[model samples]
Target: MAGHSKWANIQHRKGRQDAKRGKIFTKLIKEITVAAKMGGGDASTNPRLRLAIEKAKGQSLPKDNIDNAIKRGTGQLEGVVYEEVRYEGYGIGGAAVMVDCLTDNKTRTVADVRHAFNKNGGNMGAEGSVAFQFKHCGQMIFAPGTDEARLMDAAIEAGAEDVVTNDDGSIEVITPPNDLATVLEGLEAAGFKAEFAEVVQKPLNESVIGGDDAMKMQKLLDALESLDDVQEVYTSAVIDE
Candidate 1:
């Protein structure tokens, strides 16, 4: 796991996200609409919708915009129907990459994703090719120098699965995806707030990349993330930021 620093990665990604707020909104709106369409408009009864709405609000999406997106999803208003698709690939230095997308046109989305890979020192892989290198789990990350002892006690008591303190002194709390919101609330009530929290495809192993390869791999990832249809991108590459 050389060069693997979750806190650094999160900070870098958040900086990029702030520079692309408009694109972020589009992606969030799509998630909200699709979540509502698949589960229903009522967040209280629909876990997926509830998470989507939570994420939308976290981004400061306008209340009217959120409501309209829900209306579109429930068919009370017109909207494009989106289908979820995932693409797997290998980046520079054999780093495993996964791209999750919601698109109205599969052909166009796949073409765009493939182009991003091939043009940026990467190659597309078949389904499940790199998926096995990751785990589906909820992760809450505390910054370096946090009160590890107290955090661990609260996380375990809140039903978390594991707590690991990284070499950089940052703490990571792992939990079942379904328990993410509950565990987060519990920790917050105990006066512990995470710097980053999400249900992610946690990498089981790291692909350390540096120098030129790291730069190329980042280019590939950024290209994929810039696509309108791309919702999320995960990678096993670990590079010092």
Candidate 2:
């Protein structure tokens, strides 16, 4: 299986843990607020907001929390204005790492991210140092038992670009970033529910790492994800399952 697919599966399982659910909610709420602030509070008219809301709903975020977040974004309620930031770095085994953050204080966020990388067997990189190795796209993943033939036909008919069946039997559908909502709706309409779906920075190539290096890489990623300002972490490292 590809590195991203492997990592995604790991994340999918991790996401169900009670300990991580609160942090996941925080990140989703931030995305929702930012998306609403940037594109207006109306999901029907804002693609980013719509996607964020869908993701939040998938995670079972409360309706009141979602409403309040939208209100905050629209200035109906006071809220901190966050700035979006991206940090590129290299993890153990030279794997490319990207950290996406939303923060009111850039200095603190950067310091935390740098510390995580440095202490976890990784090094920070200059902007664009590792971004070139990734592609930005909408990706939807179905579980192992999903009907591949059915999903392929539905995704293609909905204008998806590609369908990949991973070694673990999970299926991934790729689509243009802007077409995510339409494609997701089509898939849902066809009775194909995704286990994981999002627009992501998918690596073009993968680095296989094992043993201590893999463990350290996982630590680096976990540290980054635990930071309050950090929203998402993407890496090219494929570690042993």
**Full-model lDDT for every candidate:** 0.89, 0.87
lDDT of 1 by residue, 1-241 (tens): 1226767888889899989999999999999899899989998877677777887888899999999999999999998999999999999888899999999999999999999999999999999999999999988889888998999999999999999988777899999887887888899999998888888898898876878887888888999999999999999998766
Model 2, 93-158: lDDT tens digits are 789999999999999999999999999989999999999999999988888878989899999999
Candidate 2 local lDDT, residue 17: 38
Which consecutive 10 residues in model 1 have the weakest lDDT in total? Answer: 1-10
Residue ranges of candidate 1 with Cα displaced over 4 Å: 1-3
lDDT of 2: 0.87
Kindly report which residue pairs in candidate 1 clash with one another: none
